[model samples]
Target: MSLLFLAAVNVSPEAMAQGANDEVVREAQPSQSVQNVLREEHALFSDRLTIEPGISYSYSDRSNLALSGFLALDAIFLGNINVDTVESHTTTFDLSTRYGITNRLEVELMIPYVYRSSQYETIGAGASTGGLVEESVSQGDLGDISAGIYYRLLPEAEVRPDVVWNFSVRAPTGKHPYDIRTNSRIVDDGEGGFENLTVPTSLPTGNGVWGVSSGLSFLKTVDPAIIFANIGYTHNIKRSFDDIGSSEEDVPGEVNLGDSIRLGFGTAFALNERFSLSMSFTHQHAFETKVTTDGGPEQTVIGSSANAASVNFGATYGLSDTTSIVTSVGIGLTDDAPDLTLDFRIPFQI
Candidate 1:
């Protein structure tokens, strides 16, 4: 599983400071346009006692070939020799709320629902038998619940950029993967033979362990354009599972999934009073996973590390003083990343 994090906007001291951080540099008269600029405050943070409700949808597709340890080398040359071809699709819907406790502090809460579908089929293992096996599975469940707080570290200024600090924690409120039961069946190989196979299974909605993340965000005002950068890290706490294996055979142990480092930079251009465009590049590196087997020594899982990167384009359009719509499309730049992702969000302040 993977996570996409959102970094909020910078908080300034006064109307002039906010203007300097977003729009003043582009206009000839700063005071005369204060009201027009203030109306776009949703682009950054909400005012005190304001509550904002938002929803976002995301989709990703990924595919890979599974190879046996012994035939791993041969499978490279003979692609069809691989055991199975796996394809997966994931859809996530997040309902979230944000409220401002003060001008420089904000709190947020989010709940997500996830749906996943997967398919696996034997390739050339039994080509003469019209392929050995075909399986499909689908599942949906509630995802992790998360809460966060953002604090302004530095107010916007002409010489220095606006900076904010964020901390968040996620609870394991969703169904755990280890608790899911595995299913298998015997299928025809098309060559008058039957083969026993462990069919493809749907994935869980959340990791069973608790997670905490912290990050720093900074944004610089450049008249018609605003440039922002963020860096963060997430650490998952170790958790014991009753059964970690898929088959009937059980492997109970303590699992430490991985710690990830994330970084991104983006720029948004004000197309007009009601619309804006943005582009960003993001990267995340997850360390190798570690596991301890029934009080045994800890061991690293091979090929558990991941390096993912993506380029994203976004647009924001304001419908009114307190409502806005945002949308983004992301394309993976590395093999470990999802092939493509599309997201849409609508935020309304009350």
Candidate 2:
């Protein structure tokens, strides 16, 4: 965390007791104030180095029910009902290094390791007894690595806020969702037929495509409070894979992932010199994804576009002049977002 000091004026007691003819000399003193601790966590210090290690965890669960068959006489309906439920948990550990190339520019690189687990359950699907089937998968691997550059477009002033522009590129170095084999079992249907139920054998650790993002952030300080906002867009490069199909046969195809737009704003209050609290809201909207199979015409994937929104609360504590601890909790506000997320980071300046 960063610290700011306010200048104070002190007058001699003797001078204050003297008459109007006596001139009192005042001395300026410095006192601690909380100002930029939240917005400027990674502020660029000329020719300085900073290393941050962080861990984050997220959990989400979704359930869906589908019915097939027609209604009889608009009264009692006859249908084949199926219920699908999935629960997922993810954890990531990452290390980030930032170097200041100049007073106005800095660069950063981050590498992460991810572990994921998911459970899938189906009820009343191809079963005469309405039995429940469940499967679980877990995987751990390296996540996508990214590098970014930050430029201070406008320095903070008494009448204006600090403005920064950043650009980043992400590499697809982790396990992707595509081309993973699935485990299947044959189940008997109530109508004397059999159906194959399948589930993934492993979870994906990355999106599999390269991505580029650009964003601008604004920060302003007002006495004991700091305000910040940011907006960004991400573009995912189109990539091809040897097998994008779900069937047993190999079907090569190209996948064009949906681009996304992100927006966030927050405010922080300094409780004291070493501690601060923050609250923020963030939202991301993703476009629809498209795919081309076997060089065929591109087809859009329905329901692939989604909006995710979350509210977050954060705290930062300065342990020393060169080190700080930052922690945050996020609660999902939309169906597309995770149910809850927690993050912890410790940054050391050298």
Top candidate on TM-score is: 2
Model 2: CA > 4 A from native: 1-46, 69-78, 125-130, 188-193
TM-score of candidate 1 versus the correct structure, residues matched by position: 0.80
Q: Candidate 1 residues 130-248, lDDT tens each?
A: 34566788888998999988777776677777677789999998877764666665555567745544563567889888999988777666765667677889999999998776776
Please give, for residues 2-89, the per-residue lDDT of candidate 2 as tens digits.
Answer: 1121111112243234447757545321111232242243255437588889999999999888777889999865877778889999
lDDT values for all models = 0.66, 0.77
TM-score of each: 0.80, 0.85
* lDDT of prediction 2: 0.77
- Each candidate structure's count of clashing pairs: 0, 0
Deviation in Å, model 1, residue 34 alpha carbon: 13
Backbone clashes in model 2, listed as residue pairs? none
Question: How accurate locally is residue 209 in candidate 2, as Cα lDDT from 0 to 100?
Answer: 99
